[model samples]
Target: MSPIANAFSIDVEDWFQVSAFAPYIDRAHWHSLPCRVERNVDLLLGMLAEQEASATFFTLGWIAERYPMLVRRIVDAGHELASHGYEHHRASDQTPAEFRADLVKARDILEQTGGCPVIGYRAPSFSIGAGNLWAHDVLLETGHRYSSSVYPVVHDHYGMPDAPRFPWRTGDGLLEIPVTTVRWGGRNWPIGGGGYFRLLPYNVSAWGLRRVNAVDQRPAIVYFHPWEFDPEQPRVDSANAKTRFRHYLNLHRTEPRIRRLLREFRWQRVDQAFSDELEKACAS
Candidate 1:
């Protein structure tokens, strides 16, 4: 039997732009900060090339505008280029018009810069939840084909705990491929990626993902950021202790662990890994 091919993705944003540091790092100052995303993403690209793996990159339009060559490099390497909004704003925080404009701007920039049609999106911080289900309608209207913007686990930051654990189509025919989670103790536990991938022991995260494939028989979606690979990135001194801990903890170990994950499991771009589900969504 073939191994379950899981989706591996990267959220392409810099160190200072993380939502946790929003209060401390003003958006106005973002241009003044030292940008490490290019180098970090290059490092990831090299690693993926060595491992013979491919991934979908949910890149910020802000980054793509400033670094078109980086965007081209991702496309040239056979990865999907999708949006993470224009400025990393939360979908729930924006009006429908604002959300629509953001997606349009992002898709336009990504498609122009990468020379590929942008059809997938992952909201900044996974910000699309029950309150902003209208965001899905905007996505379909804006020409996006799928989204990995919802997480089913309950969390302090963002999640819709009641949402389905795997790929499901919205009323507008846009497929919502949520980040992977495992059902345990009568609730969904986050097992896919982001800081959880760092906080949990590598074996524990692996165990959860293995269970999702072995038992649930579904493709798992795992995500991380270019910033997570840069432990030497500048720090936000004013960030609270908990925020600081969550962002910086285990940064040095991220590369090795992700390399291990790439070797241990079959991985592919989200579009390819879940093509059948996405096709069904379009057909329906």
Candidate 2:
């Protein structure tokens, strides 16, 4: 703990809605899938309460539409409510108009269900990169104050290696707070929470975040999903070996690792953790 309250976030989507499963799990069948989000989220909430920690939940409009109470529970528990778009479609794959529509639909549903204005957005799969820089302007126009949608690392699925690792003010004045990464051997490597957290040892994740906080002197932003906490989540057997490995590896360790992280680090909602940068973005 570097005496900095790092930003902690949860992308509120079910296991079936993950991008890796998109090839197999049809959106049409999403409604039919047994949703474990509510239960898993409750489990997370209980742990957070035990640790007396707060986080930001980037919820889906589709989930909010069906589980309004879940949205309310997040708000009622003293966490910030934000949007993760209408569905799990990546912003990079959609036209600007489509992105705008998805963004608005998600924000509106989140505001209504959570009873608070949503100012933060995280593109599904960390999807807004160089090709979709235009998405930031749409976020500005749509009243989003900030985004944690960019990952400044090299990955097969998503990344923009040259992007700034810390929170940056976009041309549109929307603060773009990227997921945390650490620079070593002239490359940006992801240490931000997600599958990477599950794939790697807990000490490695802690070391990366500590380095970012100590060297970069900036509050690091990390993210996870409710499904990540549920090791028993329905296995997507249809997914390829790599996908299965990525999604299911070390599932049992995730909860305890998160618990240790909470105990060791000073975590806060994104808005609170990066308030100064957000204020600067607005002022600019």
Candidate 3:
């Protein structure tokens, strides 16, 4: 029952990005930003196809609307289609009503285009923290079977350090599969996702993930965006220096590291991984 033997996922978004950097860029300007989602995702799909791997693709509804064929390709290729919200907005920023509407909008677009039950969600920027815990209910009501929206590690913008490290039942019958991390000394150390995955050396991320899975027996849910592999994306203006660094750093190295990761571990779609784990638990 090893956890490292679990799933891989992709968060589909433009290279311009989200979270702390959202405020700096104008909403209108997002349209003017280069459209790389399809091309970059196709590259990822090619890699996954080469490896004969399937992963959960938590796609932005906006992207799905523009690239319905891409959504079709993901599902047709056997990848799980899931929501990453409609406009990449944080759940905490919206009222409960707004959040519900956003989730519904995204789910409808995803299910219609992908022609599959959209049962998984990962919030834009992992925004479902303590302040927005009620989002769990919205996800359940919207027909999402599981969510990977909680980071469960301290960050300036998002996290719930007290949340469970492994997948657990949240409100109602919904499953909360938090992004993976390791508790070292007193602080939570990121394994292989987001800025930590891009900024660190490949071996460091691999070792961290191995350590977490070996000790906890919980699958290390690693995530990345298609834009991470696109080194030539247009640079958006940012007032904050730290935000700029986080968004732009290590753009070139991402794909190589991902290629290495595919070679190193067994990767499957999120739901498939969950099902396998449940079967193993039952067998035990």
- lDDT (CA) per prediction: 0.92, 0.92, 0.84
lDDT of 3 by residue, 138-249 (tens): 8888887789988879888888888888887774767888887878898777785778988888888888778777877667788998888888887766447877788888
| lDDT for each residue of candidate 1 in 88-196, tens digit (9 for 90 to 100) | 9989889999999999998899999999999999999899998899999999999999999999988898999999998999987999999989899999988898899
Quote each prediction's TM-score.
0.98, 0.98, 0.93
Query: Per-residue error at 227 for model 2, in Å?
Result: 0.6
Off by over 4 Å in 2: none
Q: Cα deviation of 181 in candidate 1 (Å)?
A: 0.6
Clashing pairs in model 1, backbone N/Cα/C closer than 3 A: none
lDDT at 51, model 3? 83
Count of clashing pairs, candidate 2: 0
Model 3: colliding residue pairs: none
Clashes of each: 0, 0, 0
